[model samples]
Target: MSTLNRISTPLTELTGVEHPIVQTGMGWVAGPRLVTATAEAGALGILASATMSLRELEDAITEVKSRTDKPFGVNLRADAADAEQRVNLLTKYEVKVASFALAPKPELISRLKEHGAVVIPSIGSVRHAEKVAAWGADAVLIQGGEGGGHTGAIPTSLLLPTVAAAVDIPVIAAGGFFDGRGLAAALAYGAVGIGMGTRFLLTSDSAVPEEIKRRYLEFGLDGTVVTAKADGMPHRLLRTEFVQGLEGAGKLAQLLPTLRRTVQFKNMAGQSWLELARDGLAMKRSSGRSWNQMMLAANTPMLLKAGLVDGDTEAGMLASGQVVGVIDELPSCRELVDRIVDEAVVQLKAAAATVRSA
Candidate 1:
């Protein structure tokens, strides 16, 4: 038997995973193969289902089951018109966790817990965290401004400890986390664990295309730009020519391409015009974004798909964090998790020794 010291936290106990490191549900990046690899490596790997159809989500869940019995999660959009149907699929597959970008309805939370699925919502503010915790969220993953994809303005160093102190439920700190030192810092902030997106995306086990991953490696901390133009939300993306054009273009200039990608996304997702409108309306109501912004939302899936899945850097936008600068190698999930845990243990021990000497 191996004798590596394993670290446990409220996150591990809640998710039933061996480590508190989580491969966040990054669209296009988190899929079955990557989830399986992360799961086998003893971390919680969340399947990104926001880009999937209901059928695709079920199929992906089944595929993951065939590959490993270890615990994993599915990320869902609470505002999606078919949210209830997707929740039913979670119980149908006996999924271990249901993670959401928005605070799911209280009823959904109760039902998910009833079915034994841990409900963790990604929140950006203390108020949102408190709301979800009051709604019975098992845990909350809070992403700060430095995070990849859609993010808020505050960095994790400021937001994490504030949210952790406000909520009774376990808080998972995300944004700017990649190594054991990040995990140790999160623990020091009273967080249950650290959730990583760019870190996990750069892993060899990630399904992201090799060239795309290499492109990500080429960026430094200054490489990422948070532009609301991509999706009408403050989204942190790589400083690519495509994104730069987006920044420089007028609404009229971007309209045609945005509409084109919308149609492409509708066909790929198999969403009817009516379904698309309803999702957009729901998003508009929740986010208070304009109709133009609602239409702009279609660019996210296709652009990310083109970049992460198809490797067309010019046509695609790269979602990334500042952590991409410090990351140079693509380690496998097992190596990543083992080293993170090992290093965290050493860091924690050294701190304890410092206290005794003081």
Candidate 2:
């Protein structure tokens, strides 16, 4: 439907999309406008439901439906206190695909599959991929350490093939990918497709402020860094002065602001202290993080809101992948997807010509 060449793969087949590309659901950045644009472009555009309340998420889904009949997905936090309610929202709207930020429970996968919704969870390890495949997920999306936000240390080049080989389901690779060349490389690595977060966030369809977008464009490859100071876990972010400040500060100095943001995130997320505690307990059990780490984890939403929503770089933390260095312009989602697919077809054909059967 998107007026462009088609590059089909198992990803397109599994998700019923025209292109083997995914617009990742970056919190605050992946809203209705961006998702609608992506769907219109014939790629799977995932709405970031992790940063929304149940009401907001419903409204977003409704908005996208009104804009386009094309298929789109919603990204959910499997560890959320109301994950079941979120999953129910998808069924209520008849959402075509449901993606998770973590490995979802077996029953959740069963419920989604029973409703005929495709289940794809993001994993960082072969073990995670095998576990989810055994749970009957339709597919798996695995991001390497080169990805932004909370991430692992494994680079995608090595992780992609390993996971692709271990799972019977299709593998969609993420991290350090931005163009058709990356897509071609991913397909060669046995991936069915590629997912991109930073590249999509830099697009014209994204709601991120113009000032923030300009700042992102100025970053070189070394302009990004992975630091655990923000939430007591490895997080990839733009190397901004604010992040540097956090890195330089002692734990005692960081605690006060961390606690403050935690409360702010709680309020903005519409969760009471009791609900936060319940969610925190679940995170502890799953992640094995200390109470301090759990408390710091609450800082992510508000800090991201300050930078991404309120446009306050001085007080905000910006999540980004190393690919930010090579990206220099903002194109609409349709333009981006079309160019990638067209170029991928060329690259794939060119690669085929270079090899011969023995």
Top model number, TM-score: 1
What does candidate 2's lDDT look like per residue over 42-116, in tens digits?
889999998999999999999999999999999999988899999999999999999999899999999998998
Tell me the spans in candidate 1 whose CA falls farther than 4 Å from its real position. Answer: 1-3
* TM-score, candidate number 1: 0.98
Error of 2 at 166 (Å): 0.7
Task: Write down the lDDT of every candidate, Cα atoms only.
Answer: 0.93, 0.92
lDDT of 1 by residue, 248-335 (tens): 9999998999999999999999989999999888878878888888888989999999999999989999999989899999999999
Summing lDDT over every window of 10 consecutive residues in candidate 1, give the lowest-scoring window: 1-10
Which residue pairs clash in candidate 1?
A: none
